[model samples]
Target: MAPLLLLGLLGLLGLWVLLRARTPAPGWPPGPRPLPLIGNLHLLRVSQQERSLMELSEQYGPVFTVHMGLQKTVVLTGYEAVREALVGTGQRLADRPPIAIFQLIQGGRAWGQAGSPWPTKPCRSSGAWWTSWSSTELFNIYPRLGALLQLHQPVLRKIEEVRAILRTLLEARRPPAPGPGPVHSYVDALLQQGQGGDPDGLFGEDNVVACVLDMVMAGTETTSATLQWAALLMGRHPHVQGRVQEELDRVLGPGRPPRPEDQRSLPYTNAVLHEVQRFITLLPHVPRCTAADTRLGGYLLPKGTPVVPLLSSVLLDKTQWETPHQFNPGHFLDAQGHFVKREAFLPFSAGRRVCVGESLARTELFLLFAGLLYRFRLLPPPGLSPGGLDTRPAPAFTMRPPAQVLCAVPRPRTLACSLKTDGPSPGP
Candidate 1:
C-alpha cells in the first residue's frame, strides 16, 4: 500500500512538471512570478505606470516576460532589444495582437479601406488620444464576453458612440459618384481602394472608417498634448525660449510665417523639438505580436506571442544619451551647433507598424512651436519659479503634463496693423 501511494504521488508531480513546461517555450525570458488569473496586475499602479515598467526591467533585465491577467507579455527594453525586433526582424513581428477595444471602436477591420464613396478631408486637430489599460484585464476571458459582462460599461458605450460618430462622418464625406477624382486626401484613396476585390482585403468600407477615425483621434489629441508640453517647457526654461525666439526673429522676421524650407536654417529650433520628444518620450511601449516562431534577444518567442517594445527605455537609455534625464537640447545638436539626428530618437516608434502620422506631426510641431514662441513669451505662473516648476507628467493614458497655468505674455511684434482703416482715433 505504501509503495502504491508513493508511485501515485510521483506520477502527479511529473504531470505537473510537464504542464508547466508547456506554458512557455524553452529559453523563454525571465519575469516576475505572476499570480493565477491576476498575473502581475497587482504589481502595477495607475500612476506612472511606465516608470514602474522601467523599474521592473532593472530587476529582470531588458528582455523579459510578465503576465497581465492570463496573457504572457514579452517586454523589450533599451535600444538594442527594441531595434532588433522592430526594425531588424520587422516582418516577423508585423502583426498586432487582436485588441478588443480597437475592434469595438473601429469595426471588424484594423486599418484603411479602398473604393469608398467618401472623399478624405484634411486632418485638423490639436490633441492626442488617451491611453487606457482597463481593457487589458478583460483579455483573460473571451473579448466579446468580457466586454459584455465586465464593469467597464461606460467604456463599451463610448466605443459604440465613437463608431456611430465615425459612421456619420463617412456618410457626410461620401461623394455622389466615383471616377478619376482628386486622390490627394486619405479618404479619397481609401474610397478608391474599396472599389474592388483588393488583394490584401484592406480596402473595405469598415476598414476605411476605422482608419479615418484613428487619424482623427490622433490628430485631435496627441499633437496638442505635445505642443502643450513645449509651451510648459519653454516657460520653465526662459533661456531656451529666448534662444528659440531669437532664431525666429532673425530668420523669419516680422509677419512672415515659417515655411518647411526654413527648417534647415532654424537648427536650434529643430533641436529643441527633437529634444522635447526625447524628454517626454510618449507611449512608453509599442505593442506587437510574433507572426511566426522567432528568437528575440536570445529568447525563443513562439508564434502569436504578444511583445511590447519599450520605447521609453530606448528614449532614456543611459548608454545612448549624454544626460538621459536632463532636459538638454544638445543631445540633438552637434558641437558645431548644427541640428543632428540621432538613431535613438524614436518618438513615433519604428518598423512597419510605426506611427503613420509622423511626418504630419513633425510639421505641426515645428509650425506650432515656432509660431507660439515667435509671438508669446511664456512665463511661469505666479508663485512658481522656473526652477521650482515640476517637470513630471501626470500618470494617465498618455504621458501628459501636470495641470497648471502659465502666462503667455505677448511679445511686441510688428503686426502690419493699419490705424486709419476702422475709424478716427479718439482725442486724448
Candidate 2:
C-alpha cells in the first residue's frame, strides 16, 4: 500500500511537470487555463467550437490562446481582429496547420501545393466519412489513438475510393495521345497542364490526381451546404421568402433561367442569400499557421503558431452588424433598397488564403438560389410549423443544417415536375 501510494504521488508530480512544459510562451496571448492532455477542449464544448471560442474572446479579448488537445492555437475573434489578422498580416499567417489525415493522405506533405485546385479534396471525402462527433474529433486530436481504435480504416478506404474513381475518370477522358488541343473539360485542362503548361512544376500524376480530387470535392460540398442553409432559412422566415420570390417574379419572370447578370437587378434576393451565409456562418474557422515570426493584435506570435481567424465572430460581430444574431436581409441593403456590399460580409473569408472557389461559389449560389426561390415556396414538413422548425445545426465537419423534411411547393409561374437534387432542367 505504501509503495502504491508513492508511485501514484510520483505520477501526479510527473503530470505537473508535463503541463508546466506545455504552458504557452511568454508573448502568446492570454487564454483560459487548460487541463492535462486535453488542454482547453472542455471549454470549447467540441461541436459548438465557434460559439465557445467567441465566448472565450469576451474573457480573453480579441486575440487569445486556446489549446485544442495538445495543439496550441491562437484564436482571432470579432470583425476587427479577424480582418486585421487575415488581411493586414500579409502572408505571415497564410499557411494551413497540418492535420493528421491530410498528412497521411499526402504521404506526409502538408497538403498539396497551391494552384486553382487544392483547397478541398479530403474535405469532400470527409463527407463520405460520415464520422460522428466523438470519433472524428478524437481522430483529429490523437491520430494514433484513432489508429489504435481502427477509426482510420474508413478514411483510408475513402482515400482508396477517391483514387479509384479518379483513375476511372482519367482513363475515360485520356487523349489518344498528348497534343495541343482545346480544353474540352476539367480533365483535359489538367492533362494539358501536366504535359507542358504547369508553370510551378506541380502537375505530375500524383499531384494531378490530388488536384482533380480537390477540384471535384471542392466543386460540390461548400456550395451545397450554403444552398441547404438558404433553403432552411427561407422555410424558417417566410416573410423573407416572399420578398425573394417577389424580386424573382418581377425580375426573372419564369421565361428565363437565373443568369449571373440577373443579380444586379435582383437586390432583395441577393441580400437574402448573403444573409443566409452570414447567419449560419458555416465553415466558420479554417486554421492557419505563421510562416515566420509574426506580430498581430499587439501580440508577438512565434513561428508556426496555429491561428484561427474566427469567421463566425466576424459575421456575428455586434460592432459591424445592426442585428448580429438575427437573420436580417436589410443588413446587406441600404435605405433606397439597393443591394449594398459590406466589407465585413466575409463568408468566403479574406486575404491570401481566401477560398479559391469564391467567384464560382458566388455565381453558383446566386443562380441556384434565385432559381430555387423563383420556382418553389420552400415549406416546413406537413407536421412542423415554420416557427418550430429546427434551425439548430447538426454536428459534422461543418455547421450542417439538421436533416428535416421540406416541401418544395411550386409557385404558379413554374410548371410542376418531379424535383431532384441534381442539376436544373430546362423544361417541365
Candidate 3:
C-alpha cells in the first residue's frame, strides 16, 4: 500500500512536468519569472502594453524576453537594438506569425469569381485589429469551437464585414485574364500572382481579405489618425502652426493642392509633418516573428518568437531625440533652419515589414496638412487659450490626441476674391 501510494505520486509529478510550458533556453534574454500559465501578464497594465514593455526594458536592458501567456516575446527597445534587429538582419525577422484563423476562414478558395460584376463605385473600406494575444489564445482550442465561443464578438463581426467588402472588390479588380493585362490595383497584382498558379494556395480569397484589410488600415485609420494629430498639434502650438502655415503660404499658396514635389520646397512644413509623425508615434508597431532562428541584440530568439521593435521607444529615446518628451519640430530642423532627416525617425517602422503605404502616407499627409494649413488658421475653440489645448495623448490603436473642438478660420489667401460691385462690406 505504501509502494502503490509513492508510485502514484511520482506519476502525477511526471505528468505535471510534461504539461507545463518549457523554461527559457540557456541563452534567451532574461525576464521576470512567469507562473504556470499566466506568464508576465501580472506585470503589465491593461491597454498600456507599450509603456509596460518600455519599463521592462529599463530593468532588463534593451532586449529582453517576457511571456504573454504561453507565448514568449522578444522586445527590442531603443534605437540601436531596434535598428539592429529590423535593419541589420531584417530578412531573419520578415515572416509574420501564421494565424490559423486566416487559413480557417476561407478553407482554400480563390476569392474573385471569374467574370463577376465590379461595383459601380468603390466600397468604403474599414476594419479593426484586435490584440494578437487574443488570436494566440484561440490556437489552444479547436478552431471551430473557438469560433463558436469567441469572446471578441464585435471584432469577429467586423472581420466578416470587411471580408464581404473585400470579396466584392476582388471580383471587381480581378483581370479578365491573369497575364499581361493591366494591373489596376493591389488586388489585381495579387490576382496576377495567383494566375501563374498558387501550388500552396498562398494567394487566395483568405489572403486577399488580409491584404485588403492591411490597405484599409494603412490608408484610412493610420493616415487619418496622423492627420488628426497634426491638426490638434497645430491648434495647440500656434507658433508651430503659424510657421507651418507661413511655409505653406509661401510655397503652395491658396487653392493649390500641395504636390508631392512641394515637400522639397516647404522645409518647415515638412519638418512639422515629420515631427507630428514622430511625436504622436502612430501605430507603435505590429509584432513581427522571426523567419529563421536569429540572434538579436546579443540574445538568441527562436523562430516564431514575436519581436516588438517598439517604435515609440526609438521616437522618445533621450539619446536619439533632443527632447523626446516634447513636440518640437526642431528635432527635424538643423541650426541652419533647413529640413533635415533624423535617422531615428521611424514612424513607419523599418525592415521588410515596413509599411507598404509609407510613400503614399507621406504624400497624403503633405497634401492634406499643407492644404489645410494653407487654407485656414487652425485655432483652439473660443475661450480656450492656445496653451490650454491639451497635448496629453488619448490611448487608442494609436496615441491619439484628446478629443476637442478646434476652429478653422480661413486664411487671407483662401478668402474668395471680392466682386467689383459687391453688396455691403463683410463684417469683421
Candidate 4:
C-alpha cells in the first residue's frame, strides 16, 4: 500500500512540472523567456534598467512582454507602438499598476492598535483615534517665498530651504490681499479652492503638500538633468552652440536678460531646448496599467496588465526623427527656423498622467538655458577636446549626465555700463 501511494505522488509531481513548463498563450508579444516564480524580475538590474529594457526590445521588436514576479508587463517601444498604445488607446492604459509599495503608501490604511494611546497617553476612544489619524494637523505648511530665499548648501538642503520659502510665500499671499494675488501657481489654485470651501472636498492641506512635493520633484530634477545634458551636448557640438548664441544675440541683444515672452522670437533657442528634451528623454518610460481586459495589437491583455510606455524609444526611433541618435536641433526646426512641434515628442508623457508641471518645467528650462548661455560660453575644460565632454549618462530614477566640469568663460566684454550706468565700456 505504501509503494502504491508513493507512485501516485510522483505522477502528480510530474504533471505539475509539465504544466509549469507549458508555453504562454500563442500570439502574445515576443519576449525573453521568463523563469518560473521569479519571472524577469531577477533579469532587471536597478542601475541598468533602461538600457537593459532597450536591448530586450531591440531583440524582441517594438512591442514585447516581460514578467515582473507573477505580474506580466508589456513594454511598448518605438514611436508608433508607444503612441498607438498610449495616445490612441488613451485612458485604457492610464491607471498605475498595483505595485506593493504604491498600494501601501496610497491605500490609506492605518496599521496598529485602533483605540490605543499615542504611546504616552491613556487609552483613547475609537472616534478620537480615527480623528487623530484624519486630522489636518498631520499636513505640513506650504512654502511660497521659495524664490526669495537663498541657501548655500548641498542640492538636497537647498531644495528643503526652497520649500520653506514657498511655504512662507504662500502664507503671506493668502487672503485679505488686494484683488486676487497671483493664481499662476498650482499651490495657489489649490489654496484658492480650499478657501472657497472646496465644493469637491478634495483640497485639504495634505493634498496641497502632496501636490507641491509632486511639482517640485517633477519640475526640479528632470529639468536640471536636461539642462545638464544640454550644457554637455552644447559643449560637444560647438557649431550648434554657436548657432544658439547667434540666434539669441540677433533677437534679444547681449546685454538684456531673455524673457519668457522671448521664446516665440528665439526659434533656434526653443528648438535647441526641444532637441535636448528629445535626446535626453529623462523619464524614459512611464508605467501604466489596464483598467479592464483590452486588446493591444490583437493580443488580449487581461485587466491589470502592467504597460510600460517607452518614451526613450519614441524620442530615438529612427523612423520618427531625423538623426535620432545624434544631437540635432533641426529635428525641431524647419529650414525657415520655425519651431516645429512633433507628436512623437512626449517627454511629459500623455493622457491623464501627463506631467502636471509641464508649463513650469518649460518655463524653467527656457529661462535657465537662455540665462546661462547669455552669461557665458560653455567650453571644454582646459587641454581637453569637445569629445572630452561626457555624453554618457549615469541613469538613476532619472537619466543624469556623468559628473564632469566645464569651463564657463564669459563672452567678450562689450559695454562697461548700460541703463542706469554712466558710460559705455572702453574698447580693448
Candidate 5:
C-alpha cells in the first residue's frame, strides 16, 4: 500500500510539470529575448518607456507582450494594432489595470481591516455638519449668497463659483492644517467632491482627493510638457512657425484675442496643434486590463491580464506618417489646407476610459497657446542662434523639452492695443 501511494504521488507531480511546460508564456510579438522573473520591466524602466517601446515595435512587430510582475501586458504598437485593439474591440479594452498604487490610495475603506477604528472625537467641531451637504444643495445656496454680496458674475462664473463653494465646504470637512494655512486651488475641488455626498457618488472624500491628485499629477504634467515641446518644435522650424503666425494674423488679426470659434478658420494653427500632439505624443502608453479570458495574436490572455497600449508607436509608425520622425504639420492637413482629423491622431486616447478632461484640456491648450502667440513673437534670445532651441525631450512622467527659455518679445500690436480692445486702430 505504501509503495502504491508513492507511485501515485510521483505521477501527480509529473502531470503538474507537464502542464506547466505546455502552457505557452506571454511575450512581445517577436523581438529581443526576456530575462526570467524580471521579464521586460527592466527594459521599460531603463529604455525611456515611450521611445524604447517604439524602437522595440520596429524590431518585434506591433502587438508584443511584456510582463509587469506576474501579470503579462500585451503591448499594442503602431496605428493598425492600436486601432484594432482600441476602436475595434474597444469595449474589451476599456477597463484600466488595477494599479497597486491606485488601489491602495483610491480604494477607500475597503483597503484595510474591516474593523479599523474611527476616532470617537470629531476630527473637527463642524466637520460632521459640513460633510452632510450635497454638492447640488451647496450650489443652490451659493448663488443667492453671492447675489447678496453684490458680486458681479461673468459667463461661466456660476460654474466657477460652485467650484469655489465646493472647495471651501470640502476644506472645512478636513482637520485643521498642520502649521500654516491650508493649500488652495484645485485640491479643494477634490475635497468638495468627497464631503458633498459623492457628487459622482463613485467615491468618498478621501477617494475624491486621491482622484483629484491623480488628475492634477497626470493632467498638469502632460499638458505643460506638451506645450514646452511644441514651443521647442516651433522654434526649430521657423517657416512652420511663420506660417502659424501668419494664419493667426489673418484669422484673428494683429490686435484681437483668438476665440475658440476662430479655430475653424485657422486651419494652419489647428494643424500645428495637431502636429504638436503627434510629435510629443504626451502619453506614449496607456495601461489597461483584460476583462475576461481572451486570445490576442494567437496567445491566450487569461482574464485580468494587464495590457499596455503603446500610443507613441502609433504616432511614429513609419507606415502611417509620411515623415514619421520629422516635425511635419502636413500630417494633419489636406491639399486644400483644411485640418484633417486622422484616426491615428489619438493624443488624448480613445474609448470609454479616454481622458475625462479631454475637452477641458483642449480648451485650455487653445486658449493659453493662442493667447501667448497673439501677444508675442517667441524668438531665440539675442546672441543665441535659432538652431539652439533644444529639441531634446526629457522623459519624466511625461515627455518634455530640456530646460531652456526663449525670449517672448511683445508684438507691435500687443504693445499698442489696450486690454479692452482687439488691437491698435488702423491709421487714417
Candidate 6:
C-alpha cells in the first residue's frame, strides 16, 4: 500500500509538470488564463469567433495568446497589427498552421490529439452550442474534434475519391503526346510541368491533382459565397443595386457578356464589387504560423506559434473607413466616383501567403456580378424591407449571408434570354 501510494503521488507530480510545461509561451502576449488540457477553448463562446476575438482584443490589445488544444495561437486584430505581422514581416509568419481537417485532407501526419475520443454528450452539446453561432466559429471548432471521431476515416476516403476523380479528368485531358501541346487548361499546364522533368517533382501526378483540387476548391467556394452575398446585399440595398445595374447596362448592355476589360468602364459597379468583398469579409481570419520567432505589435511570437490574422478586423476597422460598420459602397469610391483601392482593403489577406487565386476571384466576382445585376433587379422577399434584412453573416469557412429569400426580377431591357427570369428565382 505504501509503494502504491508513492507511485500515485509520482504520477500526479508528473501530470502537474506536464501541464506547467504547456503554459503560454514565455513573453507571449497577454490573454485570459487558459485551463489545463482544454486551454482557452471553453472561454471562446461568442457566436461569431471574430467578434469574440475582437472583444478579447479590446481587453488584450491587438495581439494576444489563446491556447487551442495544447497549441498556443497569437491572434492579431485590426489593420495595423495584421499588416505589421502579415506584411511587414511576412516571411517570418508565412507558414500554414497544421489544422486537423486540412491534415486529414493533405494526408499529413495526424496531430497529437487526432484520435482522442470526444464524449457523446459533449459532441451533441457542442453541436447544439454552435447551432446559433456563425459558421466561422463552428467551422473552426468542429474540425478541432472532427478527426477524433470514427467519421475521420470516411472523410479521408472521400478526399481520396475526389483525388481519383481529379486524376480521371487529368487522364482525359492529357494530350496524346506531351511535346508542343497547347496549354489549353490548368490541368494541361500542370501535366506539361510534369513532363519538363523538374527536379523538385513539383508537377508530379499527385502534386498536379492536389494543385488542381486546391485551385478548384479555393476558387469556387469563396467566389460563389461572395457572389451570393453580393446578390443578397444588392437585394437589401436596391438603390445600390440599381446604380450597379445602371452602370452595367450603360457599359455592356444586355446584348453582350461582361468582359474583364469592361470593369474599367464600370466604375460604380467595380466599387460595389469591392465593397461586397470588404463588407462581407468572407474569411474572418486566416490561420498562419511563424517560421521563426518574430516581434509583432510589441509582442514576441515564438517560432512555430500558430497565428490568426483577423481579416475581418481590418475590413471593419473604423480608422480605415468612413463608415466601417455600414455596408457603404462609397468606401471604395472616390469623390469623383472612380473606384479607389484602400490600403486597408485586405479581403484576400496580404503578404507572402496572400491568396493565390486573388486575380481569378476578382475576375469571377466582377463578371458574374455585372452580368447578374445587368439582367435582374434584385429585391427583398415579399413583406421584407431592405432595412429588415439581417446583415449578420452566418459563420463558415467564409461569411455566409443569412437564410432569407430575395426576388430577382428580370430586367425588361435584357436581350439575353438565358438571364431573363420568368419570375422570382430562389437564392441559396
Candidate of highest lDDT: 2
lDDT of 5: 0.61
Tens digits of lDDT, candidate 1, 296-345: 98988899999989899999999999999999999988889999999998
Q: Is candidate 1 or candidate 4 better by TM-score?
A: 1
Candidate 3 wrongly placed segments (more than 4 Å)? 1-24, 99-149, 169-184, 187-210, 413-428
Cα lDDT for residue 144, candidate 1: 56
TM-score of each: 0.80, 0.87, 0.77, 0.73, 0.69, 0.83
Sorted on TM-score, highest at the top, how do the candidates line up?
A: 2, 6, 1, 3, 4, 5
Better of 2 and 4 by lDDT: 2
TM-score of candidate 6 on Cα atoms, chains taken together: 0.83
Could you tell me which 10 consecutive residues in candidate 1 have the lowest summed lDDT? 419-428
lDDT of 3 by residue, 182-227 (tens): 7677777788887768888788677766666656644676777788
**Worst window of 10 by summed lDDT in candidate 6:** 113-122
RMSD for all candidates, in order, please.
Answer: 10.4, 6.0, 9.8, 13.9, 16.6, 5.9
Q: Which lDDT tens digits does candidate 6 get at residues 300-350?
A: 777888899999999999889989888899988888898897999999888
TM-score of 2: 0.87
For candidate 6, the clash count comes to 5
Error of 6 at 287 (Å): 1.4
Per-residue lDDT tens digits for candidate 4, residues 309-359, read 888888888888989888889999888879998998999887666776688
As a whole number from 0 to 100, the lDDT of residue 349 in candidate 1 is 82
lDDT values for all models: 0.72, 0.77, 0.71, 0.67, 0.61, 0.73
Candidate 5 regions with alpha-carbon error over 4 angstroms: 1-32, 41-47, 107-204, 413-428
Candidate 3 residue pairs in clash (backbone atoms < 3 Å) = none
lDDT of 5 at 244: 83
Which pairs of residues have clashing backbones in candidate 6? 134-395, 135-395, 135-396, 136-395, 136-396
Residue 135's C-alpha lDDT in candidate 2? Answer: 51
